[model samples]
Target: MTISWLYIGIFLVVSLGLPAVAIILAGILAPKKPSPEKSIIYECGVDTHGETWVQFKAQYYLIGLVFLIFDIETVFLYPWAVAFDRLGLFAVLEGLLFIGILTGGLVYAWKKGAFEWA
Candidate 1:
């Protein structure tokens, strides 16, 4: 029991210590040059000409999040579908429940105009 804890403690220390040591070494060894050009906003190796703090459409973010949520559903669904024969009635009902919840979310998002481009 104590040996298990010792191994865990050593693992945790090494995991944390490595990153901390790397960061400290980088800070000490890295260059400390500072200039106005360096401070300027860079985009794809091109100098930004205008306002950098432009606001984007919230609808774009909403649509993207909706897509991501539905995409992740396939990760959960694929295995369930593949093993449906072995899963029996309870698993079928559970899968249906998961789908029902997702459908409800889709309906809500649809009603809220999340699919709209404008």
Candidate 2:
């Protein structure tokens, strides 16, 4: 058991260390040149003008949150669907309950006008 934990610790260390080392190496090897063109804010291949910080509508964030919630629902559902045949009745009930909660959330969002295109 202790050896298993040691192996897990080493695995975690290496996993985390690899990304840190790569970022550090890239920083060291990369050029340090800076110019006016590089400093200017560019968007969609077009040069930006006027205020850089524009206030976005709350509706956009609400719609995005709803989309993200459903997207994660599919991630959770896929494994359950794959192992549907081997699962017992209780597992099926739990999955139904999970789906029910998400449905309730969707209905709530609909009532709150989160789906409105305006």
Q: How do the residues 12-39 of candidate 1 rate in per-residue lDDT, one tens digit apiece?
A: 9999999999999999999989899898
Model 2 per-residue lDDT tens digits across residues 32-89? 9999889876677887678868898898899889999999996999999999999999
Question: What are the TM-scores, per candidate, against the unseen true structure?
Answer: 0.52, 0.53
Q: How accurate is candidate 1 locally (lDDT)?
A: 0.92
List the RMSD of every prediction in angstroms. Answer: 5.8, 5.2
Clashes per candidate (backbone, < 3 Å): 0, 0
Worst 10 residues of 2 by lDDT: 40-49
Clashing pairs in 2: none
What are the runs in model 2 whose C-alpha is more than 4 Å off?
A: 1-49
